[model samples]
Target: MTPALPRFPHGPGSRYTARAAFSRTRPNRQVRNINLAPLVQRLTERDQWLAWMLHEHRVLTTQQIARLTFPSIRTAQRRLRILYEYALLDSFRPLVQSGSSPEHYTLGPAGAAFLAAQAGCDTAELGWRPSHTGRIAYSPALGHDLGTNELLTLLAARARTTPAQLPLWLSERSCVRRWGDLVRPDAYAHWCDDGWREMPFFLEYDTGSENVARVEAKLASYAAFTAATGTRPALLFHTRTASREAALRRRLAEPARNLDLHVATASADFTTDTPWGPWWLPLHTPTRRLPLAELASRWPELSPAYRPQASDDADSALGLPVPPLPPSDQASRP
Candidate 1:
């Protein structure tokens, strides 16, 4: 027979400690404390946008959401905690050995219901089921998806401070829905600055988990897409390492030789620098690193799509002011 474990003696005033211990032991049950009604009432349009983005992208880390939506990490943490408590958001921290991983968030049930009500449709019609969202949060591709969003988050943050223009951003889901059959870029963006005229590009964010040959094969699809559409958008490949970049460049040399497409490569090592800075090197000229704005000069024959028209109503929906175009001379530079 095993000896009984000794129980610590509790003083007469230790009832509060016992209750606190019970609460700690049953944290998952704390959802009962959330008041959903008032929480919904407290949500603003910006908050709603955060929910929509979560629904669209599936998952976003605390830092990514902070960069995309909030002015600071502290503010994001406080607000996200309230949202999480009220069931408007759900979060999980991936296991790491040393430092704690940042909390990653997905849309919670209450947020789905709120969005459905706003759309005048059933929650099912909003393409949101909490179970499904939860599963995706734990997917193997979670890191890749977050990395792709990180690129856009960086762009959004830059737009807040710099004169660089990110006129349009389309997520992978949006791309697949729109062009699923042809080629689905990880993300699509348009960059225009005083130095670089206008560049509409397809972003392929590689985590180095994929085979290099498989990655290089994507150029053929992009080439076929250009042929069909008669419009060739520059292809920007952001890889995780210099070795992968070299391999991709070698694989791309022959296939891209005769295609009308323009390819540029950049490594994730330069993420701390301005994403639009001189981090990108053309596949044809690997030695030269060009800022995004100066890339257009290299391909004079390729005509970029016109910038998408944005109205006052659209600007209001985006929650950002559209920067005025630079002077004609500055914008018209080669």
Candidate 2:
């Protein structure tokens, strides 16, 4: 008998989900039908919040989770192991050329059910299926996704130690839902210091994988957005290295100049420097690297831009991209 091909859900044939069908090489099991109601009751607010994050971002590494939510790496590992055994989360470790990769986590069946039950919605409405973790385990964008999450997680980590706050952070899906036709940013975020002085911006995390010209061309959409909305939000680029940053600045300068787009850039040192420090170099002031706080000061007009939540939009204002930071004890309570 001719063998039948396995099917996939959520229409993952798109490039975002490069591997269309189920991975024949799933490294971890997504256990199902566990008696998790009691376990869910015992789950901490942070644990619930972590599951919510996985549902939103698709995946996160142990290091990223520890930095974002837990006080210590050991502590994170201990709790994460418990969650995995309870089927509240599923995880996988991708093969690497050198050292082993950190365990990456995604919402498991129990976690999805818990979230759906909490929200009074069906599991299908939560946008998850039995094949969810299988698909992510082999995704080509795994590294890129991790990089994007790491950057924002770092910001959230810094926010914890400082007086700054990450009030609003949106994933690429949320960005698309909000501004798909006009622009496609990898992520969207706003950073605020002690005074609550804020700057909202779109992030384009570059891996030096595509043409510089192609990256530059995205400016046109931002220009179109400004034309349509009569509001301009800052567009920031974070690339892998100094050379890539230089190439982008050169190609982007003229279009940005011609279109009057608000663009700033930071390079590899982004991870080392206090992200709030003077690492960002706005195109207008190329010679001077300004602190993020000072940069916000430079553009006094760069305030939070209101988004149009069309009735057709699926996300409730409170859902999808919750706050960049974890939900508080009060907010996480059922």
Q: List model 1 lDDT by residue over 165-257, tens digit each.
A: 676677787667656788889987777776568788889998776687888778889888887777777889998778878888888877787
Question: What are the root-mean-square deviations of the candidates from the true structure over C-alphas?
Answer: 11.0, 6.3
In model 1, the runs with Cα more than 4 Å from the true position are: 1-40, 301-334
**Residue 226 in model 1: lDDT:** 82
TM-score of each: 0.78, 0.83
- Model 2: weakest 10-residue lDDT segment is 10-19
Q: How many residue pairs clash in each candidate?
A: 1, 0
lDDT of 2 by residue, 277-296 (tens): 67899988677887776667
Q: Pick the candidate with the highest lDDT.
A: 2
Worst 10 residues of 1 by lDDT: 15-24
Write down the lDDT of every candidate, Cα atoms only: 0.68, 0.74
Cα deviation of 47 in candidate 1 (Å)?
A: 0.3
TM-score of 2: 0.83
For model 1, state the Cα shift of residue 251 in Å: 0.6
